[model samples]
Target: MKNIRNFCIIAHIDHGKSTLADRLLDYTGSVTEREKQNQLLDSMDLERERGITIKSHAIQMDYIYKGEEYVLNLIDTPGHVDFSYEVSRSIAACEGALLIVDAAQSIQAQTISNLYLALENDLEIIPVLNKVDLPSANPEEVTDDIVELLGCNPEDVIHASGKTGFGVDKILEAVIERIPAPKGDPDGPLQALIFDSVYNTFRGIETYFRVFNGEIKKGQKIKFVATDKEYFADEVGTLKLTQVAKKSVKTGDVGYLITGIKTAKEVKVGDTITDFERPTTNIVEGFEDVKPMVFAGIYPVDTEDYEELRNSMEKLQLNDASLVFFPESSAALGFGFRCGFLGMLHMEIIQERLEREFDMTVITTVPNVSYNAYTNKNPDTPFIVNNPSDLPDPSTVNRVEEPYIKATIITKADFVGNVMSLCIEKRGMILNQTYLTPERVELTFDMPLAEIVFDFYDRLKTVSKGYASFDYHPIGMKTSKLVRLDILLNAQTVDALSALIHADNAQNIGKKMCEKLKELIPRQQFDIPIQAAIGAKIISRETIKALRKDVTAKCYGGDISRKRKLLEKQKKGKKRMRQVGNVEIPQQAFMAVLKLND
Candidate 1:
């Protein structure tokens, strides 16, 4: 175990973590020339196309240093704020971290946040200044910034380029030298930490875990500490480019366990794996449960496929544990699940994955943050308002408290005004400001979580010209003036299109939603009245006139009295049609509320 190194790569998005990882794999001869590719750890097609790492990937590499063979287990983690849970899981499985910072961009929001996460884990940090090949790269200045942030000596910072493979050999040496080997007893009681799992149709669920103590062998009978289920290990292996079957995986090693378990509910992340006969006395406290920041409803396009959708979600959840969902039903969309995601991007990725991976067609409602609702009868106890309809009656409700977040935005000093104005427009209060450098600034704000649920991130990037990086964490709830804005189509409320919004921007947002729906909803035989309302009062309204069928066009030479009688009869028929006409709202209209600010 002294020659074994378990570490992970941590960085902000597009900070060359994967590229550096590629270089490391190359140096270790982990991949052949033909097998080499960009973002090799990002195996999903969606991840490659989007140029991002959505999932944490673990692989083992062998390196020879000074005639001694060393085993290195590297876990590449996603850098997006929405996937912070992934980063945390990866961190819990490792003893050290490679803090990669882009040389040109210096230290950004996610860089600082990820650094803090690694620090909290008590993991050894190796600062690597990446992208030194870029013409705009500033290694000297960035090293100073890294020194200030990490409080490490300037000599300790390694200058490397993921593009040109500069200083790649030095990084490998640092990993083997600076980082300590995993500490555990190979002969002690078996104790393993399950950090991640993925479903396989052919082999069942493959659980990836890190063995902290003792060892696990092939055909061993192990029990999951949390679920208390026993299963004989059908296969135990180390993760390479492809899983390599092994006789045994010992302490201070990361590997996979397959029991051919088909049911997804049987396996849970953060569970401990121990020998069934000689089980460990304690569970592996790997990481805390993920807290979802955004809530939305996901329903099947065809109502009959509800069961299939639930099945697919269960399997997907095995791979992506951050997604939390529960059974729910909507009046307009029928049976669905109210899902909790880390952010809007996380929600979008999950939706796309459900379509591509599971082949499930789903309709997602407008995303919002969970709120706390207090009623007059139960003023002390607060009810969770995940859906807009979950809010109690306006008269009986004492006050609605919405979730607030502490937003950290790091951007160029020139764009400070643009960012501050954007935050203020979202009803954010400036908490503090500090100039990191003469050219860079960091702004902190106390903002409503709902305000940034929509286009705030997009708008922030737009206003700052893609130079700004944003990161946020929930700061509990604050009492606020909020209203449930419901969209009524011809006097009938469509529960799926309803949203709870702040009272100040409710009218403006309602008007925008009504107008946007007017453009998307097709013209029916009768005039479709699209109204946005609060309680019994209509707040904003837009009327989509019916396609005029000229009944009078046929009778060109008819008398005025005859025309009047025909018109009156047509009007009476139209009134009856309006009463019975059920509005066919397109899927786009259900998601139009998210784009209201745009």
Candidate 2:
């Protein structure tokens, strides 16, 4: 326990976290020369191609410091706001965090947010300046910013370049000298915190946990406190480059345990693991349940594969515990699940993962934030509406309250006006603004979560020229004038395309949806009228002109009268086809609604 140093690396996106992790792995001699690669901890191919860490990867390292062998458990976390839950889990399992700030970017929104998380958990913070090798890097200015933000002395701020491994040795020395070892009693009953878990087709479910008390041994019967299920510990091991099996993992150590529990529901992340025979009196706590901000429906491309889709989702949930979903059905898109995601990026990643990992082709409906719907009859109790179709009838709905978030944006001072206007256009209310420096500003706004669900981030990046960093958290729900905007193909309603929109912007958005759908949906034999409506009132409509057939081609030199007859006959056939034709909506149409501003 005295030799163990457990810590995690946290930062904003593209702040050299994984690069630094690779350097740390190399310095600690954790990996061989053959395994050296960029983003060595980011195992997902999607993560590699996109240059983002979606998962928190934990690995054990052995280092010799002061002629003594020290064990270091390092967890590299994702920098995106969408994966903050991953950072939180990593924080809970560790005693300290390496707060890495980019020399050029300084401290962005997510960097501050993640730092607050570590502070809340009372973890020791080590501020490290990365990217010192870049020509654009301003080590002195960033070091000053870190001093003001963290209030640490100038000398305490380590100057390091993850690119060239400069000051890499100093960072290791700081980890051992500053970050304290894990605290626990090895003699007490087993009390472990299940920080994360993963599914394996061959070995069942593998739970990665930190032992807070006693020890977990192979063949020991373990109990999951929250689920109240017991299973024999089939395998116990430390998480190395590969899982290295051990006879036992004692207190203040991080390791993986395989219980051979195939059921996903039984093995819950953040649950407590205890010895079944001598269970701990107090269950380990403090892990927060995931709060899903965006709700969308995921339906299989083929309706018969609904069960297979469900299985794929379960497997995904094992790795990403933040994903919340329940069975739901829609009139437009048969049976599916209504999933809750952290943000647009998380939702997109999950959809891509399902297709790539499980070979499950799925259709995602329009994404929206959850709303509280109050009715005239049941005014006291509010109905949580996740889908527009789930909203009660307009006449019965007394009022609707939509979720709001406190968004914090840090950008260059020159782009202040642009950021302000963008937020205001989305019905955002200004909270406050602070000047961190003469050229940098931090603006906070109270904005609707639904407003930023679409293209707000992209627009922010564009308006700020990629210098702005944004982060947000829910600030409770507020009553708003909202209405259910529905889309109709011909006279039939498409529930999957429907969305709950603010009454003020409903007409404009509806109009845009109609026009966008017109371009995406292919022109069929008959004209398809794409209509956007609020109840009986059709706010917007666009027509996809029918594909005209040259019925009079056979008459090379036809008379005017014969041509007129052929035209009239074709018109009649088109009218009949329009009445019975089924519109084949392409998958891209559903996603088009997300990028309306583009």
Highest TM-score scorer: 1
Clashes of each: 0, 0
Candidate 1 Cα misplacement greater than 4 A, ranges: none
Worst 10 residues of 1 by lDDT: 589-598
- Write candidate 1's Cα lDDT for 337-364 as tens digits: 9999999999999999999988998999
TM-score for each model: 0.99, 0.98
Model 1 lDDT, full chain set:
0.94
Write model 2 residue lDDT over 122-220, tens digit each, in one string.
Answer: 999999999998999999999999999999999999999898999999999999999998888899999999999999999888999999999999999
TM-score, candidate number 1: 0.99
- Superposed on all Cα atoms, the candidates' RMSDs to the truth, in angstroms, are 0.8, 1.2
Q: In candidate 2, which residue ranges exceed 4 Å CA deviation?
A: 554-561
